[model samples]
Each structure stands twice: as structure tokens, then as C-alpha cells.
Target: MPPKLPPHTADALFFCPSCSTWRRSFTNTNTTNLLRRAHQRRRPASTLAASSHPSPASPTVNGARNVPERFRELYAALQGVRDVAANHVNMSRLQLALRGLEGEKGIVRVAVLGLDNTATTARLVRLLLADPLSEKAEWEDYLQTYRMESSRGLLIRYGEQTNLAVGNSLVPTISIPSRALKTGNLEILVSSLGARSISADQTIASDALLVPTIAIQSTSTGAHSFVRYPVHKSMVCGKGVNGLLAYTGLVGRVNPNTADSIRAAFELNVGEGATPEGNDGISFVDIERAETALDMFRESVQNATEYEKGWTGSGVQPLVDWISSPAKDVAIDPAIKRLVDSTLDGAEKSIVSEEKRKVLALEANTVPEEVRMALHETVSAWAERAHTELRDSLDQGFASKPWRTLAWWKLFWHVDDVGMITSRILRRKWLPEAEKEVVWMGGKIHQAGLLNQETNSTNPIQNSTEFEISEEKSSTFSRNLWPTQIPDTRKQLTTSSVPSLHRFAQNLVMFSLSTTSLSSALSALVYVSTSTTSVYEAGTIATIGLFYSLRRQQKQWDAARGFWEREVREEGRQALKETENVLRSVIHEGGRGIETAPETEARQQIDRARQALSNVK
Candidate 1:
């Protein structure tokens, strides 16, 4: 229509869709050359020299240049160098001091002050190391290795036991609780013997070292010349435990609050302008191309208006108002005019009704009071600026950027009770699903403590039950047996021993069962019950009649005797005495003994055997 507008001239709007900014400077030759050189150094020398350059004939029209060889490789190398730099900055003083304290000085006896009970000590020690991120593995390795060598020189004096063997060591078995406080006496004793003065309050200094298998100098050493591990403070203060536990709980909390604060602040500052494209301008070539295309189109239309002259004989003036009006004279080719009209009509039809523009106007020759009042009310209530600000703030929150921050671990005084901080990281960041596993393990430790606590007390009932006793009609048996029921202590003892076997069978069956839809735990349980029934029958035959004449009466007496001997071996005199007392008491209360008559004797023997089985240790 406009003599087929110039070919080289096209729209060049310089607009960027990502950033919505015009970028013209990036198209310059100097910037392109600099970027090209940066990419070149990353390629191997052979590849760099062998690469072919672009032909001179195939020139770039806008602000775009060919990317140089090895740019991505060079950028990757730079990233590695940055990581090395960051590691150097995070190195601690403990790293430097570790070498001076190795071999002998590092081997100090740790006295866990408040951990009076073995069960408590073991639990606290385990929980401390439960953190995956902590140097827990290292500390645990050190303790296991040191345990063998520690027995010879140490005199463990704690909780009414003194000079305890290292193999049977308790929490206070390594050193006397109060002796470390009165240091001069022990110091003088060791000093007089020419040993190093390493003892301190609540600590026993020893030349006997506790060495970790994988102790790196940088990670293990601390200012006190002791091996240090990371720990989470929150773990110490978590539920169920108290005292030192509560204090240690503070470790993980510090960084969490700080992180939340930083996130909140970042949201406020970066809001909508966070993305690189949104804040920075776009590439130069795209901007130039868009601008050129728009400009060329505009120029073609202007040229057509001034130069073209056409006359149409068709009576279609109403269909084309612009063409009919000479006041807005503009010449268009008949084909171009049809194309333009069709395109406009299609676009108008496609536009949604809600998208159509609207304007308010007072009706002509109508001075209605209600209409005027409604117009004033609508304009006054609208909040144009407030709505825009609210939207801008919301847009920024959604486009939040990723955070980069340093990792910090809290340390505890009781290294064993608190373990290391790395374990905490693994629990929190690496294996959130394994949290129940950690808690369950801790619960097992707690159960062990409860058992140990019960055993150490003076209450005879608690001790006898917690440990084991064997006798017909014992007090322990009476709890489960009816008042009219005769106790069978031998059966109870045999059944108690079967727990280990049952536990083994349980684990085996559980692991063997497949977890497919067709094979479930209940189905596996039924199979185990059906199969293990034979094994239980075999155990009953072997345990009740082995080495005795196949006579049923002899087998019952023999089983009861075996039960008594096993109880005396495992639980010792006190438990045996309690069983004897319960047996005599039951006999005094009118229980019968075996009779000499053959038929009556066997019947009485079975009754006595049943009573023996019920009262087992």
C-alpha cells in the first residue's frame, strides 16, 4: 500500500518482556567484546585455538553478539574458588590449638557431675550424640577406645562403690564425685608421684588419653585443649528431661529466630523489584528489534495518507466511514481497506464485555437531585492510591528471594549427654521423617533407667519383681493368679526365658513378610502363629522332660528343680530366699504335697508342678 515499505526498516521498540525496561547500551561493541573475552579463557587451549569465528558476511543486525568459547567453564571455575574462600573465613581458633594438646594432654577423665545413675548417664550421653551434624561419632569412638585403657590407673569412687573395675564402670566409677573439687590433695598425690597437674574441680586430669579414631586436628580441638563437638541446645531442654537438659535446649533456637527476622526484613526491602529481570534492563538486541518494527509500521501509514489517491465506484460508504469522509482524507488500497476493516471488527468482537472501557456522564437536560447525589458519593468513596500501594506490597511478598546464611551449632558442657550439633542438622534438615526413630530410641533409654532405678531401691517387692525369684505360690505369681488358683512357678520361669526366642522369631517374621497389597502384617502374623506352634510344642517337650525318664511325674519335679537352679544363678540369694518364703507361706495356707500312692502320687505331683510353674522367677 505504501510502496511496500523499506525491507531493512522494522519495529524497534527496545522493550523487554521480563523486566519491562528499555535496554540500549548493552548492544554496544565494547560490552560485547568484554563478555566474549571472559568466556574464552575457560576453554582448553586446544579447543580455544581450534574454534571457528563467525563469517563477516553474516552480520548481527541489532545489539546481539555471538557468545565466546568456554564462558560456562570459566564461570564454574570461579564458583569453586569462591567456595574455597568461604571455607577459609569460617576456620576457628580451636583448629590452630589442637596440635599442642594431642597424645597425653588431651586424655582427661570426664566426670559427669549430676549423672548419679548409670541409666540416666547412658541416656544423656546417647541423646547428646543423637544429632547428625555433631561430632558425635568422633566422641563416641573416643570413649569406646579409651574404655579399655582407663581401668588400670583409675580408682572410681562414687555412690557407695569405691575402686570399681573399669569394665563394670558406672557414671561415678571413674573418679570420686567430691575429690575433684578438693584438687590440692589429689594434685599433690599425683604431683608427688611426678604426674602432670591436670585435675580441676569436677574434672580429673589424666595422662591416660581418650583418643577418637577419626580426630582431625581442626575439628576436634578446643581452647581447653579438649576435644570439642557441635551440639544443639534445644535437645537438652526438650520434653521429659530436666536440669542440664533444659539449659542445653537453647542452642538451636538462636539461629531460628534470627533467620525469621532476616526473612521478614528482606520481604519489606525487596518486595516487587526482587527478580534480576524485573530490576535490571533487558538485552540490547531485543529492545532495538521491537522499537524498529513499531516505527516502520507507523511511517508506512503516514506515507500512504499523503501520497495515495483512489476512487471506488461501489456504494459502500456507510460500511467505510473513514473512506467516505474527505475531512479525514486518507487513501488505502481496496484490498488493504478490506483487510483493516475485517481485522478491527474481529478484534472488537473478541474483546470481553468486562474489558470494555466505560465513562460516567450526566444525562443531558436531566437535573435530577438523586442522580447528582449518587455521582458525588461514588467519587468520594474510591481509594485510588491506597489500592495501588496494597497491590504492590502483595506482589513483592510472593516474589521472595532465596536466603543465604551461615550455619551455627551450639555447644554444651556435657558433651556425652548433649552429643554434637551435626546430629541436630540431620534430624531437622536431612531426615525429618526419622524424628520418631530418635524419640523412640530415647524412650528405650528412659525405660532402661526406670528398670535400673527400681533395682537400686530398698523396697523388697519392687526389687524381687524387677529382678526374678523362683518358688511355687510366690507373691509375684499371686498378682496374676486367682485367689483359689494354685501357682506354677516353674512354668512362669520357663515362659520368661522364652521371651528372647519369641523376640527373635518376631523380628524374623516381620522382616520376611513382603509389604505388597496382597501380603499384610496381619496375614504374616497368622502365618507365624501357624508355623511357630510346632516350635513351642518342641520347647515344652524338651524343657519339661529332657534327661528325666519319660515318666510325667519325674518330668514335672525335674522342671521345677531346673527352674529353681536357674533363678538362684541369675538372681542370687535374696531372690531365692523370697521364693522360699512364698513357697512355705503357701504350704502353711493348705497347699498339698505329692502322695506315695501311684495314681494319687502322680496327680499330687502334677498339682505341685503346676504350682511351681506359676511361681517362677
Candidate 2:
């Protein structure tokens, strides 16, 4: 304050002491604004707007809204649904229902009973078929229409007329067009059983049974008597008679004497209190008067109307209605539907589980661990025996007579004892025994349905000689581990080693002969050059030198023979060990190979079934 001299400087110091701080704060604010503008410029208009007004959380997201606390329970229930969908029987039922809904043609057989007179039954059938609305002129036209639309038409299977005899082995049936018998399709078939066929135990394939058929009765006293026939229990779907139709045209002419008998018969055949005097029965006049009743019956079938309680009418209505009801409505009750659904679900799951078990069983190794171990032991035993035989043969060969040991000339063409013994043990004993075991194992696999047909058909184990024929042939024909390498190993162990050993022996003999010849020549030269050398001394020296040379050659021959024997023994042992290993590996691989294809197919089928179930669910 004291140093302030200029007026402007003094004003500046008083008004803005923290000018730099204020300037820095202003610059920071401006930079922040610039950055905000730049960010806004980089973003799209839609994005910027969206950022400003954040979108609401989705209903399904994290189960934010309208989600039950135990929603997982619904998922569990759905899992069982897949099992139900996989059931074939349930699916077939559903298919049938769908077909019914689509109005597909299906058989509806009806059997008529009660009337003794076939003429009366035939007249009743004609009346049932006659349309009340059609005139006389249109009768032929209506018949033609009915014939053309066979699905909506009726075929009568009257006794004696259609040769549909009572108690016949074959149930009379009218054949439908072949086209209606397509896969997953059906056809309509309407037929009737005669009055003579009606009995307590009479069975018919008809869907419904019509009984107490209309007939005119003649009596001596100018009165009428109605005869009632017993209905078979099999034909009856539910309790009591479905519906009743009484002939009211001759009601006034009823005989008082037979009235009790007719009423008793009606109650016995149908049910108690099912007479015209009772409120439970329905009566209709015969001929043209019954046209209205028949039309009403036909209408009830089309409408699928339920019967009224205590109301009786012609049985045609209820019988036709029952026959024409959709399968879903009549066959599939709610409680039964639930039971079938549950059963189907259980069956589907069981099938899938069973298939999976089959696949698992197939995937498992066919050969038991103990069996494999035993096979390995057997192979080892074979090898041990071969080694023993080889060692014995070599020992015997070396320890044979001197003449045989010295028969070097035989080495040129003849096989050595070691080679012959090794070959014999391999081909005749080891190979045959091992092959038999392998073949037995293969047979077990084949019986299990796991063996590859190609490999089984071309097995080289059966023909042991085939392994030694040619390397190329062996390679081409051989698939098994044992036989594949047998030829090469046999050649290496026998053919290859024997010739080399023979050559070594031949070379040893030649070297010994050359040394003897050289020694003899030197002795001759020494004898000729020495003046004081006596004949006895010369002869003694030559004999000593010859004996020493013979001794050295014998030592060399013995050493060579021992070496050759050791080599052959070691080679044979090694070959056997290798063969043992191959056999073991073959057993292991063969066990796994058994039923491999079938197992894989089973797994694939299970997967496909599971996928289908999932889709159905």
C-alpha cells in the first residue's frame, strides 16, 4: 500500500489481488463447455436424446416386472410336458381327435334288434332312411345323392338277406373305398344285427345297438300284444336303455290279459317304470306319423345333444348321437385325459431312459478287465514257452555230435536249428493257440453285435499261413494286431537271423582253413630252409602247429556258435514279447470295437428323440 505510486496500478492492486486465480477458473469453465459441445457433436441426435431420457427397464429383463417369485416351478412343469409329447399312444389319440375335428370319414356301425319279423325290421330300416322333407319324386334323387356320398350313407347288414348269419365267425362288414384307408385316415361303416342274434351274451362290432323294434301284432280278440327282446350287455354303453320308442297306433287295441305280461317284459328288458303310463317312456305312431320322430333323431345326431333325464323317445336319437359324438368328447374324458397324459409322459421318459441305458451298455467295453488280464497272461505264457523251446533247441543244436557241428556245408542251404525251432514254435504252437483265443474273443464280440463285419469277414487269424505268404498280402489282408506284424516279425526273427548266422559260421570255417593252409606253407618253407632240422623234429613241430591251429579254430567256432545262439534266443524272446504286447492291444481295441456302430446309432436315436421332445414341448 505504501509502495503504490501510479493511480492505475493502485486501482489494479485494490480491485483484483487474485486476478490469476479468477482467470484460471474462467479458463477451466470455458474448456469444460468446449468438451461438452464436442461430445454432443460426436453423438447422433437420437443417441443424445436417448441418453438424456433413459429408457425404462424391460419386463423380462432380470424378471423386473410381472414375474412370479416361483417362476422356476413353471419351467419344471414344462420339462414333464416334453415327456408326455414323446408318447406315441398319446400322439395317436391327439391325431385321431384332430382328424375328427377335420370331419374325416370314420366307421359308425349300428345293430338293430327286438323285432321277430324280418319284414317289419326291413320296413323300419326304410322308414329310418326316408327323409321327411323329401317328396316322392325326389326319392330316387336323394337315394342317388346318399349313394354317391357313402360317408353319410348307411349299409344294412340284415340277417338272411345279406347272409349275415347269427353266431358267424366273420362279422359282416361293408368295404369302403381304398382311398379312405390312407395312412392316418378312416372311413364310415354303418351296419345292423338281426333280432334272432339278440341274446344276453350276443356280441357285435356295432358302435350302437337298436332294440325293441317296431312291429304290428295280430291277436284273435282284435287286440295287440308287444313282444320285448333282451338287449345284450356288451352293446349297451351305459346303464339302462338309451332311449325307447313305443308303437302308439295300436295303443287302444291292447289286450287287457297280456297287458301285465307286456309291461313285465318291458321292465325286465329295459328298466323298471319304462311304460307309456309312466313318465319315463316316449311313444310314437307307426308309418308316416314316425317321420317327425326320425327327423328329430337325425337332428340330435348332427347336433350331438345330450339326452334329457326321465325323457324317453325312439332309441334312434340317443344311439345315433352316441355313435356320431366326436372322439375327444366321448372317448377323452377330463379325468381320463389327465391320466393318459401323465401315463404318456411317464412312458416317453421311460423310453428315453431305456434307450439311453442301452446306449450306455453298448458303449461299455465288451471284454471284462479280468478276461483281458487273463488273455495277457496267456500270451505271456505262450511267449515264455516259445522262449524256453528256442533256448532248448539252440542248446541241443550246439551240444550235438561233432560231425553235425562241423557240417558247415549244410549252412549254405539248410536252416539253422534256432530258426527252425523259432518258426515251428511261432507258426504251429504260439500262433495257432493265440489265434484261437483271439478268434474266440472276436466271436464273443460278434455275438454282442459289436464286431465290424468287414474285419470279421476278412480276419487273417483263421488262415495262419496267410500271414507268412507275402508281406504285401499280409498288410492288405491283416487288420488284427497279432497277424498284421507276424509276417515281418517272423521274417526278422527266423529268415533274416538264420541266414546271417549261417554266413558268420561259413566265414569262420573259411578263415580257419586259410590259417591252416598258411601255417602249413610256412612250416614247409622253414623245414626246407633249415640245414640242422631233423625229419622227426620237423614232423613234431608241424604236428604241434597243426594241433594249436585246430585248437584256436575250435575256440573261435565255439565262441561264434555261442554268440549266434545268444543272439537268436534274445531275438526270439524280444519277438515274443512284442507279439504278446500286440495281442494285448488287440484284445483291448477289439473289446471297445464290439457293437460300436450299434451303440453310436442308439445314442444318435436318443438325441433325435430328445430333440423332437424338446420341439414338441
Candidate 3:
């Protein structure tokens, strides 16, 4: 500035003393302006416009974009989660409903109880439902399908068989496919054969009173009087009089006198005032009359040319009319509806209560703990018993003269009595005892309701013929004492390689001792015959060698005895241990199959499901 120098020269000469401060200020301002211009030039026009007009929805460097589209996406995700939760709730309710209805297919179960003679009952059931036009083959097939044996009761459902014998009781439930049952209607039929009272057949008849049903007493005309008893309200009102059917089969003849006797018996047993609430009482039908009338009707229909002329009058028209009167569609009786509703409610409440109990049980580890401890105790007791048996067998083997014999000749050729005894005890006594215990345990588990259908179908010990012993790492014997094959009493004892090796070693020791003794005797004879000092010294040396050989043989014998005892003990112990482990595993797996989740989680889920079901109901 002093000499008015060119601008470039002034800027470059900022070190000049006179206007130095001013030059410095000018240089800093000029540098900042140039940087600002370059930054402005680098920025896009859109960025500049956005910065000038700054919308609230625009994205910022440090914050998310406050856009409506993002909000919409978040709301959609929340709605989806809500929908999924609702669907899960709905599905749970549906499952509960289906279970209450018995199954998804809604199968109707009709229990047929009473009657001590199953064959007569079967024949009666066939008479009730059998078609008149059915062929002989069909009747035979039906009889076979519904055949009830003393060992097992049969369940006939749509011509399929299911054995209902749980243990000793027969729970014969006959299933009929009907849409009416899907609407919560149930029918039970109780039948009494001959003059036998229903109360006499307490096994199935007493159980039938719990369900809603109708009683049908099939009596012979020869019976003088009928027995009368109080009937349960659940059974009587379940289907009303329309459902009850009493059949009097013709024993001798189907005359007026027989009908009068049947009528008198019906009046004595199930009179008009016999029902609880004065409802039209039980209907009685003469089987012989009905059968004859049905046959005539069938014949008339078969030979019909015109309906007006084909109509025939049957003497049992009143009975037929009474039976057919209830066939028309009628609303369920209020009492019956209330009964069904109450039953359903009771069942649901029971299910919920049972689930709650199960949750508590799971939390307390009650079932698993009880089953595990019981099974463990059983296995332990069995093991202890087996150990005692093994010890006894060992003692017996040792007490036997053959096992303790040190005779060189016998030792060289004789079988290992100890090993053979051990094998025999393991094969016969121990294995059979184990199988028996296993079978008993399985039965107990089944009785305790711990076993399911799949597990209970076959015996648990059916395939457990072979027992293996694990080799001990610390055993001094070179051979392992484990069985390589299933125990067979028929097989030769030499099949066991370990026992054979032990016998060979024992024979070798005896052989050594025998050779040493013979050598010593020959040396003494030679020394006496020669009469030399060197020969006498050689005989003395041979005598000393013989003594040492005898001592070595004694030591080997003791060692062999110890080894055999130890091996047998170890094998027995290992066998017991393995058996216990197997039992424990079986029990654990069975318990685990029925194991529930954690208490809190299960309770919460059950509560939610129950709430959903209640809401739907």
C-alpha cells in the first residue's frame, strides 16, 4: 500500500512492516470468501433449495425421516402382529371346542351296559339293529365283528373293532355315526337279560348310571314276576319314555296268555307312574309279535301290485305306532338340553381343573419325581438282589472241591468251574430275574397310568435277551470279562474266550510245576547212582529249584483265584449297573414324553386359551 504495488505483489509481501496487520486481515478475509465460493459451487441446486425451504418431513443427518409413509409402514407391522395374535387365540378356542365335541369328526359314543352273558347280549343287539333282508354271511360277519370274549370286550363302531378291556373290566362302547350326536346329544342303552336284576351286574351297570341312558329289560315269558328298582333321573329323563324299550321274547308260545303275562310284568316293573316326573313311562314291546308283524309287512311289500290293495293290518299296530311316533323331527326336550349342557360344562370345568392340576404338578415336579424315584428304587432293589445272588453263586463255586483242587493233572485238563458257574448264574438266574422284574415294572407303570398306548402295546423286556458288561480299565487280567453273545445254556462253555484263557494259564502253571518236580527226582536218582561231589551238588541245586517252583506255582494259583473272583464280581456289578441305567432311561423317556412346560409359561398359555374359549362360548 505504501508504493501502490500490484495486488499480487502486495499479498505476497505481507511481511512488510508498515500495513502488516491490515494485509493479514485482508488475506484472511479473502481466503474465507474463496472457500465459501468453492463450497457453494460444489453443492447441488436441490440441496440449496431444500436448505432454503426446510420441510419438517425432510430427512436430517442425525435423525430419521419424519414421513407419513414410514408411519404407515409401522402401523401396518403392528396390525399384522395383532392379527397373528388374534388368529392364535381363535385357533386355540377351536381346538378346545373340537376336543369337547370328542374329536374333529364328532364321533358319537353309545355305551351298552349290563347283561352277564355277552353272547346273549350280542344276539339281542343284533336283533335290535339287524336288517331282515340281510344274508347269512352278513349276519356271521356281524357276529364275528361284535363278538365279546371273556378276556377282552369288543367295541363295534361302523363295523370296526376296538378292544375295550383296560385291565379286567369291559367298557363296551358302541359308536353310531349320526349328525344329531354332533349337536351334543348322547344316548346310552342298559339291557338286562332273563330274570337277572340290573343291580346284580354292578361292574358295568353301576357305571352306566353316571351317564344319561334308557334301560331295556329283556325278560322271558316263563318268569313269574319282575323285579322293580329305583331308576336314576339322569337315565330316565335323558331321552324320556320315547327312548325306553322293553322286549319280552316268546319262550313257549305267542298266545293271548303270554301277552297278558308280559303286560302284567311290564306294569309291575316299569308302570306308567314309574318315571320321576309323571312323563309317559317306558314302552314295552313283544318281540315275537313285532317280528311276525314285520315279516308280514315285508312279504306284503314284496308282493305288492298297488299300495291301496297291498296294505295289511298287523296285530301289533299299537306297539308299532308307539315306536314310530317319536321319529318325526322335534325340538330337544328342555330337560334333556339342560342335562347335556350341564354335562358339557362339567366336562369343560373338569378339563380346566385337570390342566391346572397338571401345571402345579409340573412346577412341583411331582409326577416325574415320583415315577423316577419309584423306578430307581425298584432297579436298585433288583440290583441288590442280583448282587446277593452273584455273591452266593461265587461262594458256592469256591466251596466246590473241583474249583479248589490243586492236583496238577486235574488242573491241566479240567474246565474252569468258577467261570462256568458264573456264566450259568448270569444266564439262568440273573437274566430271568431281570426279565421278570422288567415285566413287573412295565405292568406297574401301565397300571399307574404312566404308559401310553404305544408303549403299553408290547412288553418292554421282550427284546432284552442279551446283557453286556463294560470292560474295566483297572482290571489286572489281560482278557475282558464281557459277554460277546447272548447267554445260551445250550452253547458250550468254551464259547467264552476269557474263561478259556484263564484255564490255559492255570494249566500252564501246573505243567511248569509238574515238569520241575519230575526233573528234580531224576537229578537225585542220577546223583545217588554216580556217587560224585559235583553230582550231589547238582541234585541239591535241583531240589532248591523244585522248592522255588512249588512256591511260584502256589503264588500263581492264589493270583489266578483272585483274578477270577475279581473278574466275576466286576462282570456282575457291570451288568447290574447297565440294567439300572437302561431302566432309568426308559423311565425318564416315558416321563419326558408326558412332561409339561414350565409352570408359569404353561399357566399363562392355558389361561389365555381358556379366556379365549370362554369369550367364544
Candidate 4:
């Protein structure tokens, strides 16, 4: 460690040039050396566009690699979830992950509508079916939360969504409901006039994640083959289809950029930088969100496989695709008339539609008319029944299926309550600002200037150059960031936001507070409203005032403590490593003034060596 020198001022305020922190004191030698080194290390503006941001090397669209950019668009549209946790579930990498999860000799089928074709479908099938034994956690963490939490609170909150172990096991014998294979699927676009129509809403196609999402299913077949069936006929779009769309829309909003994005949606008007009070900044009316709409559906699926099916995650894509097929208007193809007629000829339950049979009868001049009549009656009766079944499933296909399978995610969990969890995790947390060039931007808060104490009037905070910091000075948690870009919230992050840790943030804050102080305030508030006697009332009032003061003091202490901890963790000794690099850059680059002390001494030694050599001659 560099020798620790006392700062010039009792609370010297300087951004540690080496560590990127506001320090109370700096060793003069270290400070000078750090500034000199930082200056040298600074790259040209073009090359160092992201230097202001931490962890610049990490990917921006953090989902699965080689997936279409549409997945990124979906993550972009989400609420509190940042890119850090946004792994593209059906991207090429996700396919690799699935293969790894299934291991050798595994045959699991995932259906992605028109996107699956004569060529790629077989290859994609092969990729997932190759393995069923190898275990992989990254897939689960990215696609769904597989491991259950011991905490009852977390379990209940995420139980339905988490119980599926899609990333762990793949059994080829698992029975896939035949009805699931053929029915209950519907197209998302109304203008989808036929199979080849491309006039679907572009806005919905881009923002709604379901457009390209995959539906995974476990099959009972031993052979690993993909079936690309023709699309169905009942295409729809409108309020009738909104139930499923509503769920997908909610998924888009699951991960937000900040609490403001949430508050704005609910139209909650709270002061931006005000001290938090009863349900103020990031306050909630309800503590628990018991969204169990899919409980019955979730339980049944979970019980069967002991693991969740892949279809549960992003199956909307395939579901939408299957329903998009041109409806097979005729239940029985004329080509299959022979098979249908013979199968029904003797059954007591069978009744022939004679008039309809004549209309459907294929003209056979070569065969006697009476023999043709017998064959035609049997085929038409079977066709009529098939038509009726298709008509009956109209409602179930559009509505009920989404509730149990693909669209269930929207209603599976209540995200509004997630805001409360957000409050806890981000309680008084500070975030570094968007990494941009050090330029004077109008209207934007100059975050770095706030840290610089010895301000120059000439600079007027406009020319002021400093790193952006999203400092939360709230009595409780509240702040904003670039609307939807999220990074890991645990460290100096750029975009990926982790709102899942909100509950953890609150628990930490409460754990740090004195119970006595909280109890005093609570007792006073509850008792003050009603009293047994005047003296008792007065005593309660006095306690209220006393506790309020204590809590206020505690808030200040908490903020200060948070600042100090961040400084040490993000900058202090850890910063020493970054500083050393800066120091190296300073010595190595350009004309670092020659080290006169060492150079002069070396020249003198050389001259003395020459004199000694003359004597030897």
C-alpha cells in the first residue's frame, strides 16, 4: 500500500483520480502520481466511448448469442429487468444449452411454427434430441428459475414459475397429450388472411416477445424426428385475442429501467428527491401479490414430469404459428375416403349422411353407381363429425389454452408487488451514471461535478468533467436510470437492472436498523390515535417525537455508511490495481520525462569506467 498521508482538509473532497472515488483525503504523492497516470492512460475520445461506464466489455443485449435482434427488443421493452439477466431463450445458444441439458440419446421436441421448416427443423430437432442426461444450470438461470428457494416467501412468490426443471431432465416416454398436439392453438394476427399473408401488425411483431418465442414439449416417441405440420385455419386478432397478448405484454414489462418507469405506468405522483414517508417514494398499498390464476394449471404440469416443459417459457411463438396455418376446411380429405368408409361401415354408432354423401361422392363412371353410393355415405358421416369437433374448440383454442400454457406467464406472477421488493434492494443504493464523453450537456445533471468540491466559477459546472453517478439520497429507496437498459445492479452497472433483489435490499436495511428505535415510533403512532388518559396520551406523543428524531438520525447515518462502504468496495484498495495500470501507462507512453536520478547516476558510472580503463591502458 502507498503510505497513507493525512488529507490537507479534515474532509478533503477530491475524486480519487486513480480509483474513481470522492476521497476525504489523498496521499499527496499518490494523488499526483494517480492524476499523472490517469491523464496518460486516457484514450482518444473515439476509442474510449464507454470508458466512463464500468465493465464496458460485457455484451449489451445480454440474452443468448446469435438469436435474432427481436429478443433484444423484447428485453428492451421490459420494465425492471436489465440486460444482465435477459438471456434469449430460443436463440442458437439456447438450443446448444438444451442439447447439453438433454445429453445423449434424448428426444425432446420444441415447436416453432413457420420458422421450423424442411431443413432447419430436422437440424434443430437433432440438436436438442442428442442429449438428455447432461445437466446445465445456465439454461435454467437464463430461461427460468429451476431451483426452489427454501424460504417460503420466495417459494410462494415464484412457485408456479419456478417448479419446472426444464433444464435438467428429458424423458422421451413422457406422454404429450394428443389434443395438445392438434388443437387449442390460435394465430395472433387478424389480417392473416391465409398461410402466406405477411400483413400482421409490425409493432406487435417487434415488441411482443412471443413472435419468435419457442414452445418446448416432451414427447413419448422413441424416434427423434421433427414434424412440420401444415398451419390451421382459424386466424384471429382483436380484443378476443387480448388475453394472451395481455400476458405477453406483461412479460415485456417485467424488467424495468427504474422505479419511475413503474410509477409512471401507475400514475403515482411522488416528489423526485423528497424524503420518503408513509407510502411515499416507492411505497405500496399491498404487501403480497397472490396471482394464482394459473395455480391449477401449473400444479398439474409440475406433477406429471417433476420438471417443467420447455413450452412454458416462450411457447407463444409456436402456439401462434400452429394456429396461423390455413384451416383444413374439409375434415376428411376426399383422398382418404376409402379409409373412412371402411372403418365406419359396421359400427352401430355410425350413421351415414346420405344427402351430404352424394354431394361429396367422387364421380366414378367406371364403378357401378349403386356401389359408389354405399362408399360415399360412410365417408360423409365421418366428415360431418370431424367438422363439429373443429367448430366446438373455437373458444377453447383462443382462450383456455393460453391460460394453461404459453400465455399463462403474464398472469402467473404479479409484478406490481415486485416494486416493493425493488424498494428494498435499491434502498439508498448509488449507481454510476451513463458512460458518455465528458461533455457539457444541457439539462442533464452533471454527476461528476457534484463530487468535485473545489469548483471553479469559470467552469460554471458546464465545462465540469466528471463521471455520472445515480446517487440515491432518499430516506428510502428511489432513483431513475436510462429507461430500460439494465445491467447487474450489484456493482457499477451500465444497463442490466436486477429488480429481483428488491426484497433483499429491504431486508438488509431493516436488519441494520435498531429495533428499539422502530418499536418506539410504532407504539407512538398506534397509541396516539386513542388514549386511556391525558398523561398517557402526552407520554405517547413525547415518544413519537423522540423516535422520529432518532429515526431521522438513523437515516443520515445509513446514507453516510452506505457511501463509505461503496467507496471502499468500489474504489479503495480494489482501485489500486486499476491505478497501477494507469501508472504503467504513464511510464510507457510517449515522452515520460526521463528518470534523471537513475539516468544521471548511470552516466557518472560510465564516465568513471572510462577513466579506470585509461589507467589500465
Q: Which candidate number has the best TM-score?
A: 2
Clashing residue pairs in candidate 2 are 106-187, 106-188, 107-189, 450-594, 450-595
Residue-by-residue lDDT tens digits, candidate 1, 1-617: 01221222212112211111112224688865664464343221222121242332331211122222222222222222222322221111111111111111111122221111222222222222222222234333332233221111122222212222323211112322222212211110000010122222223211111111111111112111112221001011111233223222222222221111110000011122111221111100111222233334345655332212110111111112211122123222222222222222222232322122211111122233453344334222222222333244323322322100101011111222121221232223221222233233223323322212112112233334542444443444344321111113223433564343234333332332222222333444455667755545544434443222223323443354345334423332232334334322322221122122223332333234233323322
Across 1-617, the per-residue lDDT of candidate 2 in tens digits comes to 01222443222221111000011122377775764564344322212122232222211212212223333222223323333434422332222222122122222223333222223333333443443343332322332233211121132321112222112111112322222122213222222223334443444321122112211112223222221211111121111232222222222233222221121101112332222334213222132223344445445644223222122333333322222333453422222222223333434555666667766764563545566566656666766665666566556555556325344444433324534543454454333343444445445434433333222222233244322334343332235523434345556656776566556666655665676677677777777899787667666656766677666656765676567557755655555555554454344444442233233333344355334333321
Better of 1 and 4 by lDDT: 4
Tens-digit lDDT string for candidate 3 (1-617): 01234454334422211100111223588775764464344332212222233332222211221223322332232223223333222222222222222211222223333233444344433333434453233433454345443222333333222223222111233344322222433232333332234232233322122231222111212112111111112111111121233222211222221121121112112322221212232333233333443445455666332321211221123322221123124232222222233333333444456667777754443235676678768767876876787677667665666555633334544545545544554455334555456457656654544434122212243345443223342121112222212132213332563466466556666666776888787777777777665775767757776777666656676676677567655655665556555454445444333344433433344444334333321
Model 3 clash count equals 0
State each model's CA lDDT, in order.
0.24, 0.36, 0.37, 0.25
lDDT of 4 by residue, 1-617 (tens): 11222333323433221111222234688776675554434321112121243441343434333323323332222211112212211122222222221211111122222111112222222122211232332322322221111110010001111232221111111111122222322111111111122223323321122222211121222222111111112111111123223333443442221111111001112322221222211221110011121222345544423222222221222322332222255322211221112211211111223323333442211233343243334334433442343234322332333222311122214324434332332332222222111011101212212211221222121232331122231101112311111122234321123332233334433443444456556666657665654556645655665565446545643454344344423432222222222222211221111221222332333234223223321
Q: Which of the numbered candidates is closest to the native, going by highest lDDT?
A: 3
Candidate 3 structure, TM-score to reference:
0.33
- Quick one: ranking by TM-score, best first? 2, 3, 4, 1
- Using all chains and alpha carbons, the TM-scores for the candidates as numbered come to 0.12, 0.37, 0.33, 0.14
Better of 2 and 3 by TM-score: 2
Model 1 error, position 287 (Å): 69
Stretches > 4 Å off in candidate 3: 1-74, 82-377, 406-410, 413-435, 446-497, 500-507, 510-542, 594-617
Model 4 residue 578 distance off true place after TM-score fit, in angstroms: 2.6
Worst 10 residues of 1 by lDDT: 186-195
Model 2 TM-score relative to the real fold: 0.37
